[model samples]
Structures are given as structure tokens and as C-alpha cells.
Target: MPSSNDSRVERARIVASFGRQFYVRTLDAPGPDRVAVTRGKRTDFCVGDEVTIRLIGADQAVIERGLSRRSELIRSDRYNVKRLAANVDQAAIVIASDPRFSEELLLRMLLACATAEIPALILANKSDLATAWAAIAPRLQVYRDLGYPVIELAARDHPQETRAALSRYLTGHNTILLGESGMGKSTLVNTLVPGAALATREISAALCAGRHTTTFSKWFDLPSETAPSGAIVDSPGFQTFGLAHVSDSQRVHAMPEYTELIGGCRFHNCSHIQEPGCAIRAALESGAIDPIRYLLFSRLAGRD
Candidate 1:
């Protein structure tokens, strides 16, 4: 029996957002239900935000303030930036064999993960597609070689294996699930968190794209035998993951493999493309850097 208050404050987490309304789970409550909350007109909130709220009714609350975020995941377009989730422990990037995997997009995601100081786990879904899987195996290997955890399995076909591989990361941290539409991210979520019942759709063979099933982002708590409190932020599929917030230096720093040669470049502002005595180019030729990655850096940095 909670009462409305003018001065009382309670800690909570924003588990979901709907326009001006937010669904928050109160940490102060003994119950597990969420209460609808609203914030000041200028204040914004995203999934996984820890907030302080004051009760207005039995089932309603007003957010007083959001706690400082430990981490934030954002999506940007040319004009605006959209915060996807906050307090992320890691990013589980899902990709598949069909519709031709985009190496450039994967690199961008990895860069985003790296810049945010979030670890990345690459999952190659649809491994049941033998031909498609075979084609991408080499690229997947490259990611594995670079030290990011990589796992390949069709969620539906290898549920046990997939679960085992993901359990280590999913058991104790708040991971954000990200991928292009039709890449089976929702399906994987369904497999990870039983009773999630997230809607999923098949990829259109004609377009090789999946229907957008998830309309918004929400946090799902994963209760496993090992870690009952682990959670993941499920996000809608993205056609493009924008990095408008990341600066040139941050982008460069995100490339972990390039760290060793960063200060070795001939010029402090060397574009890493067509620059005389560029350390990156030297590393590319010396087999110290992955050629594919260097090419992606060149293109993403807008180098000739």
C-alpha cells in the first residue's frame, strides 16, 4: 500500500519507455511489478536507466531524477542522436549468413562497442545455413583471432550449444542485443530468456531482410541456474547504426589492433590513408593489421 508523496523518493530502473511514459521497476518494492512513470518535459529516459521517483498513485510515479549512467548505447542519424540503452555491460552483436553479411557494418558495431568501453560478443546466427555459414566462417575466424568472443550456431537448431556459449557472458552482466533486421536476434533472445515470447519473423527470401518485429527496446531479466539477476536490453533491429557521437580520435582508438602503431605514424594527424610513412599502412603491409579492417577504417574515415 504505497502512498503519494511530495518528498519521498525511491530508487528504480527504467525497464521500458513509451513516448512520454516510462515503465519502471522500483528497487524499493518487495514486489516485482512495474509502475508507470513520467518525467519532466525536458528530461529523457532510456531502458536500463536507474532513476529516483516519487509516488503519485498506486500504479503511477513521477521521476525525480535519473542516476548517473555507467554506460550508454546510442544510435545517431545525421540530424539527431537516439540513446538506445544505458548501463550496458556488453554488446552481443548478432549476424547471420543470409542477405550477405556486411563487414563494414560489423566493423562499425565493433567500433561502437569498443568506444563505449563495452566488451563485444559476436554471434553468427543461422549456422544451420550450411552454405551461408561456410562463406562467412573465415571472417568470423578473423574476429575470433582479434580476441572478441565468437560463436556460430542456429539458435533453433543448437539451442543447447548456444545457451552454453552465451551463459558465461549472460549470467552476470547486462548485455545489449543488436543486429540488423532478420538476423534472428529476437529468436536468440527467446532462446536465452524463457517466456520472453518476443515476436519474431522469417526473412523474406525475396529481399533477404527480416520484418521489424520488435517495436521498442526493453530490459529482460534472465534467471539462470548460475545467475538469476543477469539481464539484457533487447532492441529493435536497425537498418543503420549511426556513430554521429563518436569523434575521429575516439573512432581511431576503438580499433584495438591499431593501438601499437597509433603513435608511430609519421604525422600526428596522419589520416592512415595515402599519408607518407603511415604506421597503419606499414602495419597493413607487414601483416600486423588485418587488411579488411584497414580498408574499413579508410572508408569509414572518408579517406581516398
Candidate 2:
């Protein structure tokens, strides 16, 4: 403990972060940066986690310290607090034909990202069932209109099309792919991982839901050829996500489509609920917005 040398000290900046585990290289050089660091991290760390290192040798370093984040994405945990997924550039909400799209669940996810100002994308998968996509599109228009870049695809059918649509948001950014069971999130993960196979479940037409396969969130690196610079985390699909941490207004702000009507609302305190003279209400009454979505937003926004 009495080493009074620079050999005991090391410092570097975080460039690509995925929760507690992050990849860091040396500050001055390139070619994979000659190093990687991780130090018993249990919470969140992102691309910008400023860290002090414990020098092990010329060949290795350990993250002994971390700086706080400028912003973060988090969802409610059991103890009445939001758990963080630090350094995520965007949250990709995946939806498929069966286990049918839960707009309520979707809104909660969208609000979670919006609370932190993180961009959100809606990936509508399972295009082999074009009829299913058509049936679901009207329900999804809320999220689309709200400004999430909606991507339509089938997990197995068109690799080139899927790659082209998703490649842009994912470049050099750590994104989380999340949705309910049977939504082909695992299929998507399988696509991203080179020679790695993640199990996927099928849907029950009578019940209209997918059998659960994943029990907890796990990380996976995308194929270097497809996502060369950064990686993606395919989180365990959830039945519901808590939105108590973010307000209704903040949720609306996270939604891109609502950008125009946000400040246009008559009342600064508008909940878009029973408030009179509300622009959102006007849109709702005129069928400019989906009622199912409005209902979900009201219920979740009530948490504030």
C-alpha cells in the first residue's frame, strides 16, 4: 500500500459504455487502444464514464474509479427507485405480431428514455406476416406519430433490408433492444452475434402471446462486420415497465411526434387528460391520435 509511484496510478476516458461493463483503451494511441478495463462495476457506466485506473502492468489496467453521468436511462425497480442503464445513446423498442403489441408497455419504455432525453426507436418486426403488420400498424401509429423512427422487418427474411434500416442508429452507439416475449428480440440478437445462437419462442394464436424464453437481461456483441464500432444489449423482455420517475410532459418530450403540439397545449399544467382547452384533447377528439395510446399515457402519466 505504500507505493508512491505513477506505476500505481492510471487514468483514461471511457469511449464506449454498456452499463457496468465498458471498453476502454489508452488515451493517446489507437489500434484497439492496447487496453480494456472493468472493476467490480455493479451499477451503470456509459461511453463517457471518466475513470481512474489501478495499473496492473504495461499490458493491463483496472477501473478503480468512475465519474457520474451527464444523463441516463432507467426504469423502476422493486425498491421504489429507477435502475440505470448508463451511456445508452438510444432505446430500441421491438414489437412483433403476437404477444401482441402492448401500447401501455411501449409507452412506459418510451417515457423512460424520454425522461433522460435519449432517442427512442420502434422496431416493428415479423414482416413475413404482412397481414399481421397491417393489423398492428394502426395501433402503432401513436408511437410512430410521436416521432419514434418506426422500422418494419421480419427477423429471418431480409437481412439486407433490416441491416440498412437499423445500421444508422446503431453506429458507434450502445443501444438496448427490448420488447415482450415472442417478439423476435432473440432472433434479432442471433442476427447480431456472429455464429451465436439465442433461443426464440413461438406465439399461440388463440392466446396471442409468446412463451417466455429469457428470464433476465443479458448483453451481446453484434457481428463486427455489421456493427463494427459499437455493440448492442438484448435485454430480457418485460411484461410491464414502471414510469413513475418521469412526468407526462417529460414523456411527451421524449416522443418526437409530439414535438409540435407539446408547447401548443393551452395549459402549462396540462396532463392531456380531463383538462379543458387542451390541444392534446382536441387532437384526441378529432381522431388525430389513437385513443388506446392516449389511455395508456394517461394511466402511466398518473404516476407523476
RMSD of each: 4.8, 7.2
Cα lDDT tens digits, model 2, 193-272, are 65444222211222243444654343444666677666676665677687667655578776554566768787888777
Supply the global lDDT for candidate 2: 0.65
* Per-residue lDDT of candidate 1, residues 46-97 (tens digit): 8899998876655567888889999988767678778878998889998899
Task: Tell me the deviation in Å of residue 138 in model 2.
Answer: 2.4
Clashing pairs in 1: none
Where does candidate 2 have its weakest 10-residue lDDT segment?
A: 198-207
Clashes of 2: 3
Provide the lDDT at 301 for model 1: 71
Return the lDDT, model 2, position 121.
86
Deviation from native of the Cα of residue 291 in model 1, angstroms = 2.0
